[model samples]
Target: MYSYKERSHIFNTLNSYAFDVLVIGGGITGAGIALDAASRGLSVALVEMQDFAAGTSSRSTKLVHGGLRYLKQFEVGLVADVGREREIVYENAVHVTKPEWMLLPIYKEGSLGSVTTSVALRLYDRLANVRKDERRKMLSKKETLDKVPFLKTEGLKGAGYYVEYKTDDARLTMEVIKKAVEYKAVCINYARVTDFVYKKKKIVAATVKDEISGDTITIHAHQIVNATGAWIEDVQALDQAQKKKQLRLTKGIHIVIDQSVLPLEQAVYFDTEDERMVFAIPRDGKTYVGTTDTFFEDDPINPTATSEDVEYLIEAINFIFPEQNVVAQHVESTWAGVRPLIYEDGKNPSEISRKDEIWTSKSGLMTIAGGKLTGYRKMAEEIVDKIVKKNRFKHATNCITQVLALSGAKGLNSKNFEDYIKNKAKVGESLGFSYEDAKALTAKYGTNVDDVFIHAKNHSADLNLPLALYAELSYSIEKEMAYTPSDFFIRRTGMLYFDIATVEQYKSAVVDLMSNTIGYSDTEKLIYQTQLDLFIDDAKNPK
Candidate 1:
C-alpha cells in the first residue's frame, strides 16, 4: 500500500504508466470509481487537489440511508434505489458504518402527522427492504419522550421510528481509496489537474501539477473521468463542454457540541418551522445537529458556516429539544458542505433531486455530477460499465464490489463486529492501552488495529505524545497517507468534529511530528501549521 512517505515513488508510477482510466478527484465518488476499475484489472490513477475527503465528503450529515426526506418530494424511485444501496454501503464497510435508530418526533403543526408519519415510515421500510428487526414502528407520545427525554412535549402527538446508518463519512472515503490502492490503483493527493492533454481534440491524458512540489506531469490514460463533486464546472471548462445541464451547489452545515453540554439519548430527525427536516444525532461523546439546505454561490472548496447557518441550526435544535437549552456558546465545532445537485427547473434547494448523472463530452472527458454519498458504488459501477460498453475500455469482469470489504473491514460482518471489537480490545489492553482507549482504537482501525497497537506500544519518548495519540499519528503517516496535521485532525480521525479539545490539546506536538517525519523545512512547517489553524478556527468559530 502507498504510504505518505512514498510520494516520489507513487508519482513516478503515475507518470510512467499508461493508465486505462484516469480519475480526477479523490472524494468518495472518485475513490469508488478507482477501486471498481482497479479491481477489474484496469490500470487506474487518481488525483486530488487537496487532501482526500477535504471537501464535502468530510463535511456531511454523516448518515447513510435512502433519502427518507425524498419521500416528501415524491421521489419514490430514488428513495427505493438508494434505500437498497444503504445496505451495500454498510456491509462493505461495517466498521465505519453502524445502524442508528432515528426518532421522528411528530408535532401537531409539523410536516408529518401521526398516521401519515406511521404510514410513510412503513412504506419507507418496505421500499428500503428493511430487515424485519429493523422495520419501522409507531411510538406513543410517552414512548417518544421516553426515548428522547430532552424532546419538547408541547404539541407532540406521537413519533414514527426507523433505522438509519451513521458513519464517519471522511473515513469511509479514505478507506475506499485505500482499498483501491490495495487493488493496485496508483492514487496521489495534492495533485491537481491543471489542463487536459488532447490528441486531435480527444482527451488522451491530463497535465496534473503536484501541489506540494510545484511540478507538473502528464498522466496518459485511454479514458478520463471527472468526478469532482462541487467543482464540476471548473473541470468542465477544461474540456469547454457546457450544454443544457449544469450544476447548482447547495450548502449544508452541521454543528457539534460536547455531550456533557446537551446529552442526547436518541437520534432525532425533526421538522423545522419551514418544513425542512434536520437531524440531531449523538456519537462518541458529542451531539451534532445539522444540515440547512440553501443555494450557495461561493468558493466551493472551502465553504464555511456563517452565523446565520449556525443560528438556524440552533433554533431548529431548540425547537426539537427545547429542554436541552442549546445556544451558540454551546457549539464546540462546525462544518459546512456543499451539495452538487444537478440543476432542476422550478425546484428549490430542498426540492432538488439528488440523483447522479453522467455526461460524455465531445472530447471524451466523462463527467459525473449530482449524487449523494449513499449511491457512490452504483454510480461508479454505472460509469465504468458505460465506458466498457462504449468501447472506451475493454473489460468483461462483473462488478464484485458488492462483496468486497473495505480496507479495515476484512473478515468481519455486522453480526460479529461487536465480538471482534471485544476480542481486539483485550489485545489492545494487553498492549498498555486503557480499556476505553483500546476499544476506541479497535473500533477506528478494525482489522487494521494490530499495526496501531504496535505503534502505540513502541512510540518514541522524544515526542512526548500519549500512547493512543502517537499510535494514531504514526499509523496515519505510515499507513493512511496523512500528509498534514489537518488531514490527521480533520479527516483521518475526525477529531475536529467529535473531539475538538483533543485537536487543540495536541496540535503543537502533531505539527512538530509531521515536520520531523516528512522532513519539512521551517517554511513548509509554518504553511502547514497555518492551514491547520485556519481549519481549527473555522470549526470552532464560524463566520
Candidate 2:
C-alpha cells in the first residue's frame, strides 16, 4: 500500500526518469492504458488536470453492462462486443462491480413492447455469456408489480428482467489508478499538460504544470497517448497542422433522488416521452434517475444541469410511476457529463457509435476517443497493441489484465465485506460505523477502508462527526487525489448526491477538514461557503 509520502516520492521519480510511455488524462481509459502498458514491463506515467474520473467517467449512470438501448438502433456488433467485455470487467473488479437485475417495463404505447423486449433480453443474455444464475427472465404483469409496486400499472403489460452489473464509477477509476501504481506506473492527479514538446516536428515530450503548487516541469517519453475524454480535441488542436476531424461531444445529465421517495425495489428501465430509454437505478440508499441525451454547446469539463434537464427527468419519472409523482424537491443532486463520441456525418448523436477509435497523428501522437465504460480494458489492449507494433518493440507477453486483479480487489467475495468491516472496527472503537456506511466505504475503497479508518482513529479527538469525519476527508486528500471540496463530496464519498442535507449540515466540518490539507485561509473558506450557498440556491430556483 502506497502512503501519501510514498505517492509524492513516486511522482518525483517519474519526473526524473525518461518514461517509455506517457498517458495524458486520468480517466478510466488512461488509467487502463497505463496499467496495460506497465503490467507488460514498460515504464509509464499518467497525469490528470483534476481528480481521476472528474469528468464523464464519474458522472455516468454507473452501469457496467452492454447498452440495451443500442439494440433498438441495431448496433449488433457494438452491443455484443461490450457485453462480452462486461464479463471480464466484472470478474476483474468483483468487489465494486456485481450482477444486478434490470427490469424493463413494457407500456402499451411504448417504443418497445413485451415481446420485443423479451427477445432483446434473450440476445443480450447470450452475448454476455451470463451464468445460469444470472440469466434473463420474463415477468407477467402481476409478477412485475410484485417486484416494483410503484410502477404505473396502467401499462397493463409484462416486463423483462435481465442481468447487468452496477458499480461506483469514480471508485472504479481510482482502483484502476491504484492498480497501475502497484504495477510501477507513475500516476499523479492535479497535474495538467499545457502543451506538447516537439522535437523537430515530431512530438517528443510534454510540459506539465502542477495545479496545486504551481510547479512546472517537462517530462520526456517515447510516445504520448492522449486519453482525455472530452478534452481530446483540445489536445489535438495543439498541433493545428496535423489536426484530424474526430470526436463529437454529446451531453448526458443525471439526477439523484431518495429511494424512499420513489420506493422501487428493483432497477427500472423504461422509455420516456422522447422515445429514449432512461434508467432508475437504486444505489447507496438512493435512486439515480437520468441521463438525458442531447447536443451541448457549452464547455464540456464543467457542465451544469439545466432546469430543462431536471424537468425532463421529473416528467419521465412521473409518467412512469403516476401514483407517486416525483418533483424537483425529490432531486437531491444533479450532474452532467459529455460523451466523446467519434464524429460521423448525417447521424443523430444517439445513433453515433459507442465503439472506440484510435487515431495516430502524423507527428506520432496516439489519441483514443469514443468508447463506453464497459469496453475500456479491451480498448486499452487495442491501443497498446498498436503502440507496440508501431514501435517494433519486443512483446514480452500477452495482455494479462484479464486474469490480473485490480488493487485491493484480491480475496474479495460478496460475503466477506461485512466481516472485513467488523474486523477493522475491532482495531479501534472509533472506527465503528453504521452498517450502511461501512458497506458503502468498503465497496468504494475495497481494502483501502483500513487507511481511512486508521486516519480517523489517529484524529478521533478532533474529528468525531457522525456524517463527516476528518480522517475520511484526509484519506481522500492523501490517497484518492481529492483536491477540491466538490471532489471530496461528489466523487470521493458521494455525499453530494446521496444526501444533500447531510452535505449542507456538515459544511463546516468539511471546510475544517480540508482547510489544513489545502491551505484554505478563513477568507477562502468563507468564499467557498458562499459559492456552495449560491449553488444550493440555484438548485432550488433554476431560471
Candidate 3:
C-alpha cells in the first residue's frame, strides 16, 4: 500500500482531491489524527517535511509511560488520562508495545520515602486502573539488591515496583499511518507546507513543496490542523498568528552502553543529586540511561547530545551505580529529543507541565501542541471531535480507536501475543531461518513478518545481505516508505543505537543496495551517504 516507489502517485493524488481535513506533521500526533479522521469517513491528507517520526517521535525515551513523576507535581488528572490510554495503545499495537516492570529504588535521604512511595504507587494503580496481575509491589532492601545489585548501598531502604509500557516509537508511528492508509487517508513525508491560501479570511488551501522532486503543488482542503511538535511556532509564524501562550523547547538526551559495560538486568528509575529522575533500561543487548532536561534554543532537527548533557547523565549513572565506574568512553551511542512544552513564566524546563492545548487562529487554522506520546490517540479523538461538532457532520461517528487494532495487530492482543509470536516464528523456521532470528523478527513485525520472509526468500542472496537484515530493509523500502539509509538504520531497525557495529560494517553495502533498488542519482547517493555518516558520527561522538 504505502511505498517509496508510489510517492509521486501519492503527491498527484494530493493535488487532485479536495480533502475535508489536512494534517500538517507526520509525527505521532499527526499519524493519530489521520487514522481517526479517515476511519470516520472524512477525506484526509497529511504532509510531513521530513520522514515520519524523524523528529521527537524517533528520539524519545521509547516508553508509553503514564508519567509517574507527574504525581509529584500534583497533576493527577493528567496522569489518570494518559495512564488509562496506555492500555488502549498497547492493546492496539501489541508488537510495538510491551509491559516493562520498572523498579523505583527507595533511598533514606531521597525525596520519596518508602511509606510515601507506597501510598503514591497505590494511588497510581487506582488512578490508572492497573490490572491486578501487574499491580505494584513493595520489595525489601535485600530483594531490591537482588534485582539490581549495582545500586548504591549507602541510602538503601527498599523499592516500589510497577509496570510501564516500553515501545518502539518510530515503528508505532509507521503502523498507525499504515492503518490510516487502509482507510484511504493520503499521507506523504518529505513534503513541506510552504504557505497557505485563504479566502474570506478562512484557511482553505496550502502550497506544498516536494523535498525530493523539487516540485510545488497546491492542495485544497476545508480545514487544516498544525500538529508539528517542536516546530509549532514556525508553522504559526507562517500564518502570522503568534499568541501569548508560546512553546518552550527543552532538550533531553539518552546515552546507550553495551551490556558488557553496564550489565544491568532490570530497569531502574533512580533519583539524582539534584532531585531529578533518570531511567536506566536494558533493551536487546544494551543498557541505556537518560535523560537530562535543559532549555534548548537551537534547531530541533537532528539535535545531538552535548558534552554537558552527556556528562550529566554519566554523573547520574555513576551516582546510582557507583561500583560500575562508567566513564564517557563507555557510552556506545546517544540520541537527543526536544520537547515542546507550553511556555510558563518563572518555571524551569523540568518544572514545565506536559499538558496539551488546542488553539484555533482567526483564519480557522487549528493547532494542537504539547502532549505526551502516551496520549496521542486521545488527543486526536479530542481534535476530531471538535472538528466534527464545528462542521456539523451528521455522518461522522464517535471515536472507535479505543478498540481499533492497528496495522499488523489484527486478532492479536496482549493476552495472546506471546503465543502468536511463538507460532509465527515456526513459519520463519520453515522458511530457513534460525528460531531465535525468526522469533525476533516476529516480535518486531508482528503479523507482517510473512511479507518480510517472502522478501528474504526471494532476494536475500542477490542483495548480498543477511537473510533477516535484507528482509527488513526490503520490507521497509517497499512497504514502509523508507527512502534513506538513516530512515532504515536509525528509525526502522534501531541498529544505529543498539548495534553500531552492524551499521559500520554494512553501511556501504546498504547504500549500494538502496541506490540500485530506488534508482538514486549519483548526486542523491552521495548526499544520502554523507547524511548517514554524519548521523553515525554524531551518535558516537555527540556534539
TM-score of each: 0.98, 0.93, 0.99
As a TM-score, model 2 comes out at 0.93
Name every residue pair that clashes in candidate 1: none
lDDT of 3 by residue, 1-543 (tens): 688899999999999989999999999999999999999988999999999999999988999999999999999999999999999999999999999999999999999999999999999999999999989999999999999998899989999999999999999999999999999999999999999898987778989999999899999998899999999888888785444358899999999998898999899999999999999999998999998899999999889998789999999999999999999999989999999999999999888999899989988889999999999999999999999886546678888899999999999998899999899899999998889999999999899889988878566465667888888998999999999999999889989988998999989989998999999999999999999999999999976
RMSD of each: 1.2, 2.5, 1.0
Model 2 per-residue lDDT tens digits across residues 102-203: 998888988988788889888888877777888889999999999988788886598988888998788788888889988888888878889887877889
Clashes of each: 0, 0, 0
lDDT (Cα) of model 3: 0.92
Extract clashing residue pairs from model 2: none
Per-residue lDDT tens digits for candidate 1, residues 1-543, read 567779988987888989999999999999999999998888899999999998889988999988999988888888898898899899889889999999998999998899888888888998899989999999999998888887889999889889999989999999999999998999999999989877887889899899888988999999999999998889888885533257899999999988897788689899998889999888987889989999999999889999999999999888777887888999999999999999988889998889999988888889899888998999999999887775646564778898999999999989999999999899988888888888998887889889888777567677878889999998999888899999999999999878889898889999998899889889999999999999999988987
Q: Which ten residues in a row have the lowest lDDT in candidate 1?
A: 238-247
Candidates ranked, most accurate by TM-score first = 3, 1, 2
